[model samples]
Target: MAGACVAALLASSACSSSQDASPMSDSSASNASQKLSGTVTVFAAASLKESFTTLGADFEKAHPGTKVTFSFGGSDSLAASITGGAPTDVFAAASPRTMAVVSDAGGVSGTPTTFVRNQLEIATRPGNPDAIGSLEDLTDPKLKVVLCDRTVPCGAAAQKALDGSKLKLTPVSYEQDVKGALTKVVLKEADAAVVYKTDVRAAGDKVGGVEFPESADAVNDYPIALLKDAPNAAAAKAFIDYVQSAAGQKVLTSAGFLKP
Candidate 1:
């Protein structure tokens, strides 16, 4: 009887020890699997805010130990950051021209792939009381118009479209970026502004967007690439891959962005 009791106690101890170690072992493995751990700072164009935020969340969930930090602004500004060594891991520009600036400066790791396409839209206050229908209407002296500065991608596209139609518009303000241009229209500060289709979609009820036929002449391609000196190269590559993936494309498309 004594021997049997001792044997039973030993068996119980061994089982408990094994069970306890199993969870710890599993935890160690889990930590090890998350080798790509760090904050990857991404500089993306303003129009990409909504879609990039969603994708960032998905990336964090997929890679347990990774954190993504994004700076959303004009493509020109983003290009300046990467060119000036702003400690950015990735860059997503609204135009290939902007991306080329970085690539020319040797700031990019590899070739950038075009992820999405965007075009200009006429954004006005909800209801569009002015009865503005076409690009030529923006030139009306009574109507207050706003446009992005020539440096920004949306502004460049807007310029191209306006030039194609031979419409001369003297906007009240030349905004620094697409969001800034849209804000003028949303706040009713201006009757209309040329902004990206994605910006119009993200603005919700703040403004109404009118698709102009001339927009086809000014479509801009969004390109993304990893930086050469990325602090977290693995995570940067992974995030870039995610943006080009089918799932990422779906997210952008849902946000009203055109696929590349």
Candidate 2:
């Protein structure tokens, strides 16, 4: 009886040890001991709204007692805000040129890393009633087309594509951001608008997307950096790490963003 009891006790101890070493258990232990807290403020491009919002939630969940705040707008505007003294923890821009705006001002803590790439696409009314097939279609004088301002990344990409194709387009209006440009088509205020493909996907059935080969020549590389005056530097770094992690890539790729 005593021998049998000793063998059973040893088996139970091995089972307990196995459970403690499990991946789930290790993850729980790591999270419980994680020192991250406070809020991480991110200034990002408008095109990143959907994916970044989802990432923010995931970050908060992964680190309890933490919060994430975002200010989404044109990368150029966000860069201006950063250089002009916005107290943000991180900056994710749609283009390297826009990121250079802040980096040149000595506002970045470290070298900015490219996280993704985006391409321009024509966003038309749902079902593409106008049957706009390519960039040339947007040049029709009768069509009310909108574009992002020449200063923004999407606008710059669109302009590059147009220039490459030797196409001249006179838009009815130029919006401040990609979302704003897409909204024109979604609201039927414009027959079409040149914006990022990711924005078109985020709009769901609200808009239709038309791809142009010239867009290939105008793809933009997105970069992210930690601010020199970050209010929550530690959390900011963690958030950046998370964004570049496999899990983050999955979320971004699933949202139609291209891997860097």
Candidate 3:
């Protein structure tokens, strides 16, 4: 009777241990799945905000298990962040010059592709109160013109256009980014500003855009790339491929970007 009782106790203990081990195995599998389920962070240019946001949502819908997160700002600033280790999986810059900074820093995985192009436009207060119609008009002594600083892509393009046209503009303020320049015009701080065409469209009723012929001389190309040290390389590559697809091009084009 004693031996039988001891045998029963040992069997019970063994069964309990087996049941615990089974859940432990399941937990390990669950952890692995969780590891595969995470967000892919993207740093993109501010001009790309509208299009990229639309694409990000589409990407999430297509890839049910992955999340797409974005941080949009000036291209130069975005490149600086990637070089500084901001934990980004992908980067989309408004200029090749800015993308080169990341390439030089060994932050990008491969050659960045030109995904889209953008041109500068003169944004003014709605209703054309100043009757600003041309790039040469911005040089008017009475107009309070604003421009983006030379450090940003839009600023560089604006400079090229001005140089091409042999026109000099003395702006009331040199804003930090294209949007900032547009804001100056929107707030009536300046009578006009040279900002990206996309920005004017995005601003909707806040401002009006006037196209100039010299803009053709200074079209800026936007580039996109996956980072070399991306924590989620697979997802990053997928996102890149998606951006270069026809559907992605449609989204960008609809938002005023020129297909590359």
Candidate 4:
């Protein structure tokens, strides 16, 4: 009887152990699977504003109590802020070259992933008042042109496109970011601006896009990564993963950003 009781007790113990390990009641497991709730601050390139804003809204809706905040500016400026100790969870840059600054400083959690590719487009006022057709058209000098500052990714791509065409352009202004350059056209302050295809798309009828052949040589690859000091690490990872998901691609591609 004693031996039988000991075996029964052991059997009961085994059952309890197995039950404890099951998915139904493990608190750690529950936490991992539970809906994440927190604010995730993302520092992203100015050109990503529209698409990222849409994705951020979708993410917040899907996660219930979660929220996403963004600081959008030039990719170089954004990277500088992240490495300068400004608090942020994720960094999405207009180019892998910009993201490299953060990765090299150990400011990111893991390897950065390219999420999209963008090509340069000539953004002209509605109805294309300047009647611009190609990269060489901007050389007419009668039209006021704007280009992103040479320090930013958009400017870099523009430079490459201009170099490919072997055309020299002296713009009225070299704006600090793509948005700045795009804004000039949107506001009708400039006749045309060399910006991203996505920028022109987001601007809608406010601006018209001109695809230049030289843009082939200046495609910009955008990369994103979770920051090492993310305040909401779990939420940040989920957001980064979400941006790489099919749903995110739908939003990005719709806005004229190409697949990475």
| Model 1 C-alpha lDDT per residue in residues 116-225, reported as the tens digit of each score | 99988999889889998888889999999999999999999999998999888898999988989998888889999999988999999989888899999899999899
Candidate 1: global Cα-lDDT?
0.91
Q: Which ranges in model 4 have alpha carbons more than 4 Å from their true place?
A: 1-23, 26-28, 31-33
Shift of residue 155 alpha carbon in model 1, Å: 0.4
lDDT values of the candidates? 0.91, 0.94, 0.90, 0.92
On TM-score, who's better, 1 or 3?
1
How does residue 169 of candidate 3 score in lDDT?
81
Model 3 C-alpha lDDT versus the unseen true structure: 0.90
Cα-based RMSD of candidate 1: 4.9
1 against 4, candidate with superior TM-score:
4
Output the lDDT of residue 57, model 2.
99
Say which candidate scores most in lDDT.
Answer: 2
Residue-by-residue lDDT tens digits, candidate 3, 219-260: 999988989999998888888998999999999898899978
Number of backbone collisions per candidate, in order? Answer: 0, 0, 0, 0
Query: In candidate 4, how many Å is residue 66 off?
Result: 1.0
C-alpha TM-score for every candidate = 0.87, 0.88, 0.85, 0.90
RMSD of each: 4.9, 5.4, 7.9, 3.4
- State model 4's lDDT: 0.92
